[model samples]
Target: MDNAPNRTLLDLQALEDILQQGAVRTLFQPIYDISKQSILGFEALSRGISGTSLEFPERLFCIASEQGKLSELELLCREKAIARFVEQDLPGKLFINVSPNTLLDPSHPKGETLHLVEKYGLSANRVVIEVTEQDKVDDGFLLLKTIEHYRQLGFSIAIDDLGAGYSGLKQWSELRPDFVKVDRYFIDYCDQSIVKKEFLKSIIELAKVTKTSVIAEGIERLEELTLLEKLGIVHAQGFLLAKPARQPPRALEASQVTQLNLRSQSNHNEMSMSVGCLAQIEDAIGQSTRCKDAHKRFEQNKSLMSLAVINAKQQPVGLLHRDQLTEVFAAPYGHALYAKKSVVELMDKQPLVVDENAKLDVVSQQITEQEFDIRRHIIVTRDLKYLGLAPLRDILKHITEEKIRHAQHANPLTMLPGNVAINEAIEQRLRRQNTFSLAYVDLNHFKQFNDLYGYASGDSVIKLLADVTVQVCDQSSCFVGHIGGDDFMVVFDGDDAERLCHQIINQFELQSKAFFTSEHVEAGGYWATNREGQKQFVPLLTLSIGLVRPDLESCNNSHQVAALATDAKKEAKRYRNSYLFVCNRRKPAAPIVRIKTTVHECSV
Candidate 1:
């Protein structure tokens, strides 16, 4: 017992040594609620300060508990944690790590812990004690009693890292904790790994049934964060939210919240077919015919009153304002002469024009960085083909709305832009006829595999597919989108088409091996399978792609090019088992693509 450094001093001596000499100090790591996209809390991690570097408090706590000094160690960590959380004025929850053995002690010093909470002006409610799922914890009766005791005292309880190697599914049955934290190992590659995503997603479903709050830890990228949000995760603590510091973080800003809203609202509105190019955005601006409403809108807003007028063709031709019109009337150049002169003489043809397809952030950055003319409203277009004017105030308001909605409404898997983004992308591609590739990807026998392993495992598989697709395509030239579930589409060009598809599938299979049972991985490192009784080897995950490039010789307009690409993509789907090519060239319609052998013979 005396051999454990933590228990060497015994009782009062150990407590005094920990406080006066400061044997333990707590460092915080930010934990985010994946659904909310806001910093929900910080996980208080304990570290033993040696002469120089800090030691893992887990080792220290484990050794102490083994030596019968868990009570002493837990008390020391709790005291310091409360002091720091209070001093920092952290607005969100303070999550402190606890050894399960410590909490299982019926005679643990709850009285001292209560006194410390009162001393620091913190409610027992705001603190969540996180016990690691990495350890073997089977003390059901004691855990229950301890939880009941904490519940009465207003303290929340959480089971940390519940889907990792040493997970305890039985804790949910026994302890009924208020929160369940999905571990980082499950979340780290969630954006791309279907197996890991399903695994974590099942945990989320379980949390929902238990009515427990779920938070995903270790989010580092926008795609990973988006996937978690879509999977219905609510509380996240991660580096993207902010690194833990000595002070509390400011709540997510209004602008941030607005961005979230715009994304969410867009998703729901985007799925149905849009009438024409930029029709949705045009509807969003609430303008029917251009000039009728402009007269009324200009009258209502007196400050910076001006309107740009154009014919039905949207050719910029006139500028009008109450002030400008009044000046023209009073001038020696009478109303007849002023009105007779073309309005184009006054209107700035060189007006600052913004591409309508750009994100809100891009527009905001442009406004901030560029020198401006007197116009407060900037003309925007889809790919610089004029759509409408974005008033400065409207842009600010829209940005603010975007943050609020996007923070709470992001998707958790297949972070390739969601349904709303899918619509915008398709519209853009169809309008431009830029000869990009639209390759639809779906997993083979994924559902059966998921059913066999359970939903958590299924989600992991889905996330893996998304990750592979994103990695395989070039972010600069290719546009990848998730049309919900495991179905995904990648837009690319002719140059590296087949090679890129094969590369993505190959990488996905390689990454997915670890998640599969050894029996699933056949000899020669091949993860072979039976697809409808056929001996199919997904050693390089089987991906079906349809490629369409503009047939410059056959098509006169961009619309025909888009239709050709669409038709080619459909043909590609018919021969969907492997890497296949379908080009929209000028040749007479040939025999349809069938097996990989037939398609390969023609394309090669």
Candidate 2:
């Protein structure tokens, strides 16, 4: 035990030697942009010599802090990280960690970081000063001033480990940083905990309001990454995407990129149908044409209400109303006075112009926001080049038709899409020849529960299940539909279908426990009468999910997909607990006498 003092002395000496010799090694971990499927930047992490007492970062930094050399060590790490980053020709921004206490220290040198970056030929604009929340700040005003100093030098600022240390929301609000990274604790198992999910949602919403970009750090599992993506988090840093290394990949793996692209395409397909279908092909006059010429064309074609004025590039510049021209021509000697002038003088230059791919509802909103006369005609374009015109009357008609159709095919209880809409979703996927998974979800022993509880309670349970499914699947590029009564369907466009299925089952089990009485829950079930009027022990409510990956070549329609999913669901019901049965058969054929499947049982 007496040798412990000697060991400590030796460790301190080793740390000193490391600092003097400049033996810090820098490894970069990538921060990914999910929406673009590209690398946004990298966070530089520092380490010491391998196989030594000071090899780990935590020990090295702790010893440095004890030795009153924290600022020196941090400066050395920053220099080395910047040098290595430039030497390796890394891409995007470089995030270097700096403590607040060090910045507030009187002895700490200012402008050193800027000098090193300039010496290494790197731009200050590419470096982000990540203020770590490891130590308390005695003076918040000085720290803010120091941060402002760094900002004036063209350095971006970021707050690290938010919600895990002092001055969390306070620091965030005061700094108004360009980036804020949520701590790892909130990100772990976010999919399983509703509280954590709500916390993240609130953080995201706050970031949106503050106009601050959020980055989720310490992501280690695919489930965590998937949930973060669903919550609208675009920037991420973690082991699942890529580990810290001296040399890292410039782009994601091909398979991962393909999956992201597929999800994006699926989302695009599900967007409201474009307003291009309502476009009416009509003749447009050039901006340089005479007003008299436009008036003559309007007179010849009595149906023409307006003429779109285009420039040399075929882009819409304005709109000329027929009534305006007639009023001008009706004035005393107006035709002789203004007939020779250019049409640009009489055109409405601020007419409503929208892209052909814009949503009908969005275009309607834009039209309604305009003046009464200006809202009469909308100029539609493809890539800024005028294609045709969309009249207000046509837009209103199309929207009315869509509302009627949607009302007819929507489920009354859950307000989810019904059979006709489900079939249409499946057929759309089939037509695109895209490979996707279909899951037919059914409640187990629901009739028995309905018999014991009143219909109101039963309806509550069904709605609860629907709510859980929607909440879990929201923004996941997956479609949810209610077939009827207690049966529902989900279409998955990504590869994480099985994991998502488990989430749904787990969430349903936890939320459904409220419907049962305490005595019934402890007993594991309740005494109920079966359909044959015989007394039996019916288990609590559970879910049965039948999943099938449909083959684009063999499965030609939604009917075939539905049939295969139904068969798979039968196999899932055989298990007593909540379960998932994945069908191996891709083709739609006669029901097999012997089934081939894989089953996963989920414990409540």
Candidate 3:
């Protein structure tokens, strides 16, 4: 009668028995190299037997900490995890979590983890001892020394869950870990949250200055990972990228990798805007060539504005302008006086030779800021080797064209991207096979409000709605489009789709009252004729957001996503007042069942 099958908490005796019996297990979660499109490493997560009080890893660790068996339990988990990591013949670095308290334990076996790794015949370099900050360490000096000792033994150090724990930055400053794992809380919807974006930005900047690498953890959305890539945080780990499993994946989603690369290419194209449309490599004159020979070559190419003088090593030493050289040869006996001399003697010594990859804006600035007349032609080079030349006029023309193209595609009312850009964004996401939420936001009861208030007032309402959406969305990651009229589209490339739409609904409702008449505001409705010409009461201006998500395998193209999202939007319109309807379609692998949906109604 006293014997009970289950207990609320795992008994201390049971914990000891589990450890003695070697019942601990390990699962591996992959860390992705977004740029490389490959598995960079795997983080080893410890697990306990199911149907037991120690089934939960967190509970197991907590009980161990309370019982002063933290070091013993951690070491056991590490041993079991690493043994399996070797047994599975897993590829990539093995990231093992170790509490700082356990790291500084006086009785803790020093270099035991290292020995375990060596015992498995795995290189110490492949093992990254992640110093977890869950338990705060009081003595910084001891912790630093302990981390350093591991470093000297050839183990790379990492700080886990950077922003989640106390003194994460302090440890980062003191220990200067080889890598810092950003906390999941900040990464959840980082693409749609400015606060998160700015916070991660500062961390990335800090990493750059300190020469430490950053690993964005808990990236569960394509948009979040996309933003991380744009910010140059290439190393990442999350459920969206890959989930924890018994074995590492052969590779990540090829489409997602392609999408990240496409974005990088787009950024490269933007940077090239500084260089204009000028050729990457232009013709140049060798310094060893005689002045007369250089003159003959310039004469051969009548369109040449200037020629770059390069030495034996292909390094640019000077510039020879057609106008100045022509002026020189025009003088009486000038050709005879300088015919035999090397081009270096006649060429302008202070030449402006820029790297081929230099931005056009930077090159233009250099040209305008120079004391000498460097406006003739800019000599471009790659790794000091002559590449090409660009005239000032060509750069200016390209810049103007780029600006004109952007302006042409922008929406006239809100100045946001119109249909073309939105299509391109959708296609780009589809190509990468990244999961992103597409929300179709259309105003509710807009025809009645527009008909009553006139087009001018309606335009004002549309602009206000645009302002609210832009204000709530993370401008860095979210794409807002003015599709046309009262129908707007927002593609959330991050995980904060639900929260973002609700915020938009909340803001629009609170602000729409200002545009209503006193009587309409008091009554909360306006009398309007239906399509049949019968009089009916219509609600005030409110927004209906229909959200849909299409992953790579589920959706073949942007059109499919648009169609599904439109369907979701129609579903949302069925409800009165402000409403949000999300399409929660499951993947094909899941057993097909009755379709389920979630509707959120906002009465305000």
Model 1 earns a TM-score of: 0.41
lDDT of 1 by residue, 380-441 (tens): 55522336666666665666665554433335564456655554555565566656555566
Please give the ranking of all candidate structures by TM-score, highest first, separated by commas.
Answer: 2, 3, 1
Residue by residue across 346-465, what tens digits does model 2's lDDT show?
886556777798778767765654434534688888865789988888887787787677678888999887898788889989998877899999999899999888899899999998
**TM-score for candidate 2, residues paired by index:** 0.54
Poorest 10 consecutive residues by lDDT, candidate 3 = 262-271
RMSD to truth, every model: 21.2, 15.2, 18.9
Best first by lDDT, ranked: 2, 3, 1
Better of 2 and 3 by TM-score: 2
lDDT of 1 at 336: 55
Top candidate on TM-score is 2
Q: Which stretches of candidate 1 lie over 4 Å from their true place?
A: 1-20, 34-37, 50-54, 165-167, 252-604
Model 3 CA deviation exceeding 4 Å by range: 1-10, 255-604
